[model samples]
Structure formats: C-alpha cells, structure tokens
Target: MPDNMALIEERLKLYMINLWSRSYYMGTLGNMSKEVVERYIANQRTTKSNADHLSKENSALRH
Candidate 1:
C-alpha cells in the first residue's frame, strides 16, 4: 500500500542519516585513523562542485 511504501521510505532515510552520522563521527574522532584520513583526502581530490552531504552533516554536528 501507499502508506507502507511511505513508511519504508522514511525508515530508509533515517537509516541513511544514522549511517552517515556514525561515519562522520568516526572520521573526526582522532588522527590515528589512517583509513578515514585517506578517504577524506580522496573525497577532497574529487572535482565535485557541491559539498558532500555527509561532510556537511558532520560539520553541523561539530558546532
């Protein structure tokens, strides 16, 4: 049903946000996480004009 689909969509969005928040938090935790640093560097090297959504969320959480 439409209601069920809507509920599923909402849950999926929440799950994605949860995952992004965790990833971002882990990335900011410390300098010893080499993998996180490499991933961040790789993301920075990309030519995308818009800011990454998860990065934005991570920054907002910091303040």
Candidate 2:
C-alpha cells in the first residue's frame, strides 16, 4: 500500500511537471487499476479542496 501511494505521487508529480503531455498522464493513469485510479483522483480533489479552504481561512484571518 505504501509503495502504491508512492508510485501514485511520483506519477502525479511527473504529470504535473509535464502538463503539455496530457496523453502520457492519461495513459499512465489508465494502466492503473480502477480502484487505484479512483483513489488518486479523490486524493487530488481532497488536497486541492483543503488547500483552497486553508487559503480562505488565512485570508479571513488577515482581514
């Protein structure tokens, strides 16, 4: 499970750095099992949501 998480993070980072090659990212994700892919997507959305919430909280605190 740890290894799988690491692999997902690595692939995600690689894809983020190479946004121009979206096909590669989609292909790599397609090779993963459906469960793993779903988890990865969920993690990404959760992370972004958390970041956005934190940013809003910080802005509110500053004002």
Candidate 3:
C-alpha cells in the first residue's frame, strides 16, 4: 500500500493533469498564470488540512 504523502502527491498530479488537459482543450493553456497555480496550491493545502482534521476527529470519537 502507498503511504499517505505518496497517495496525496499522486492524486494531486492526476488532478493537475486533468485540469491542464481541460484548459488546453478550452484554449486557456496560455492563460494559466501564477495566480491560478497559487490558488491550486492553496486549495490542495486546505483540502489536506481538512482531511487530517476529519481523520483525527474520527479516531478520537472511535476511542
């Protein structure tokens, strides 16, 4: 089984690939600016933090 970090990285890469492909098809390939990349990074960080919090809460409840 893959570790948590590895799994996250893999999923992130897949998501980026899908996003880029869609953008390319929509003719927004050149419009991908730094702000967009930063937003994506921030979104990923928020998602990971939320997932971690949920996992901790679930474990605590279980115990």
The whole-model lDDT of each prediction reads: 0.73, 0.84, 0.79
Residue pairs in steric clash, candidate 2?
none
Candidate 3 wrong stretches, greater than 4 Å: 1-31
- 1-54 per-residue lDDT for model 1 (tens digits): 999999999999999887764235554567666786778768866734345766
lDDT of 3 by residue, 1-63 (tens): 469889999999999887764232424446787788778768978999999999999999999
TM-score of model 1 (CA atoms): 0.35
What TM-score do all the candidates reach, one by one? 0.35, 0.55, 0.51
Q: Could you say which candidate leads in TM-score?
A: 2
Total residue pair clashes for candidate 3:
0
Tell me each candidate's RMSD, in Å, in order.
11.6, 13.3, 12.2
Model 2's number of clashes is 0
For this target, which candidate reaches the highest lDDT against the unseen true structure? 2
lDDT of 2 by residue, 1-63 (tens): 999999999999999897775233668555678788878888988999999999999999999
Give the distance in Å from residue 51's predicted Cα in candidate 2 to where it truly belongs.
0.5
